[model samples]
Target: MTTRTFTNRLTRALRERALSLVDTGRPEGLVFLGAAAGTEIAKATGFGPLEKVCKPVIAPSALVVALRDGELGAVDTALLSATGAAYTVGDVILMLGGGHASRSVARLASGAAAFGVGHVALGALMLRSGIRPKALQMSFHGAVAGTVGGMLLREDRGNWPLATYGGMLAALSALATSVDHGRAPSASVLAVGGPVFLLSDGLILARRKVAGGSLAARALDVGVIDTYATATLLLLTGTAAAARSARGR
Candidate 1:
């Protein structure tokens, strides 16, 4: 081919590649924004220290990159899991301030609200992923159930706003269970994470309800941290696998 023709082809190819990046990058950008908004809002409400504000942002952003490029493996998965664990640990550390007794209801309520915003972002991601209308409806149902559960829970009983937060988290977890991860070989793996996520949050809510000094209550307390850490690790690993599958296609 002539030099002019080759130059024209090269330019066209580059333009197309750039456009493709923009297309995929849109959802990834939303993911990052969601994470950042969650982290910053949670920080503003004193959910955790300011120094840890980037925890939420970093975890989701890294997952986005992994999804886009399909760069993930055992070590990468470990790091992602570690990041999630650290993020949860930050909240755990807050209890050391004075335990639940030291935390005000308003602060707790605000933290839950901040997390609701994050869940909204997660919903957007779900829609972008092509979740069916029926599945979406079921997610709302999960929210309702969770809201009722939250309202009934002893410690947070009658706290409509906090119940709403529980609803949001429940919705996301439910949605995760029903989402079509496409033909990604790890679709089953992705489904597993959702239930674990639900379990983690359930433990948190249960812990609040049962403030006894009993062994079961203590187990619930510790389980909150353990399950949360495990949930994050599993969810991110599944995400990575799905990403890899997509990239291969």
Candidate 2:
């Protein structure tokens, strides 16, 4: 081959590699961006007292997921944005010290409620997009199972109200996913990510039931949180890419 032709082929190959890297790295980069943004917001709002740790830990990945969903136009951008905002606010509330147990429960409940609203909105969007009714029904069943498991496994019986609220929210999120999965551009990602998200939350609840210092609790905590973050990143980014591909077709 001519030297000039060889050089041209090499350049094209390099360009393709560069594009691939950028595409793969964008989601992770966005996660870091969201985390940094959430940390700054927490500090500025005096919500950093506890969330300086927790918010930075979770919000980034979650926000990245929401942003990816928005970018793909697979879900309602406004609703996804609102969900992130609400969760951030709720985290701040939960982290706030100097509150009675009841007060803390109330704050947590409020956060869960906000999350439920987001889930309901997501479900509505899915339905509007023509998701099948069977998907919705299956989601409802999964939600019911989640609620029952949460209620039964709650550590503090006195916090039943909070547990109930959380269970309800989980159900709503599942319901939303059911609808979303029906028309999702990437059903496989949704299938895996959705269950992992639920499992993560379930583990979080399970931690409350288990002894704080126990190895089981610690394992559950780490496993769930990490899985949740990773799953969100995968699900959102995968779905977004798939949606874009479908649109192109």
Candidate 3:
């Protein structure tokens, strides 16, 4: 590559790093992986069939369901009334594991997998019928993600939610693979990494703020904080996970 072109790409990569402060710890890798994943899906199943397989099944919240039933109104929204944002995204995720939403997601994933198998079987038939390449590309990706998602959802680990996020991230990474290049890490890494990075950064940011010293001093504080924080969080989360698993057995 020309020097100018190499410089431009390097510049973009640096910009991506800065942007990642608000994004995932793994962004380029995530987007490229999702997009590239979308591409493989395209190859296996056409876009239309794939969409049908992977559409978010409505696992609406109680408030949302109440709204649908006309029992609640926009003025009474809990999210709007809450004092903390903690209940926002975090709760929405946990809620999926709670009630009908869990069953609904599981059922939808299962249906998608079944339909995907049929699509793959018939993809063979359509090759002779001479379907367009673009359509085939989309179909393949849809089938892969849908099928893979359904299988992963059955994991007994507390990873159903993480798996959903992972599959979507992977599919998205696949979609944008042309821009970012790497062997995509599995969703499980990301599932844990999200909290790992957040807790690590939060502890550092907190110590830096509280240490009330110059940058170099604060940098030293960071080393101390990370050492303690990571050990503690890993111990707690790992212990909890182990207990849950033992209970299951």
Predicted structure with the largest TM-score when compared to the true one: 2
Candidate 1 residue runs with Cα over 4 Å from true position: 1-69, 72-103, 136-150, 153-158, 212-214, 240-249
Write the residue-wise lDDT of candidate 3 on 1-249 in tens digits. Answer: 554654455455435433432345434334423433342343234343432222111111211211222221232233211211221232234223321123344543443343223223222222222222344434554565566456555654443653454344333223322121111111112123223433332333234234243554344333433432222222222222222232333
Residue-level lDDT of model 1, residues 88-175, one tens digit each, is: 4434443433332233455556555544554454444444434443566475657666656656565545566656666666666666
Model 1 pairs whose backbones collide: none
Residues forming the 10-long window of minimal summed lDDT in candidate 2: 94-103
Q: Kindly report which residue pairs in candidate 2 clash with one another.
A: none
Candidate 2's error at 192, in angstroms? 2.0
Worst 10 residues of 1 by lDDT: 94-103
The model with the greater lDDT, 1 or 3, is 1
Error of 2 at 112 (Å): 1.7
Summing lDDT over every window of 10 consecutive residues in candidate 3, give the lowest-scoring window.
180-189
Query: What number of backbone clashes does candidate 2 have, counting pairs of residues 3 or more apart or in separate chains?
Result: 0
What is the model-wide C-alpha lDDT for candidate 3? Answer: 0.31
What digit string (tens of lDDT, one per residue) describes model 2 on residues 83-157? 455555544554453211223555656655655564555445444444434566466656666666566556456
User: How many Å off is the CA of 63 in candidate 1?
Assistant: 5.7
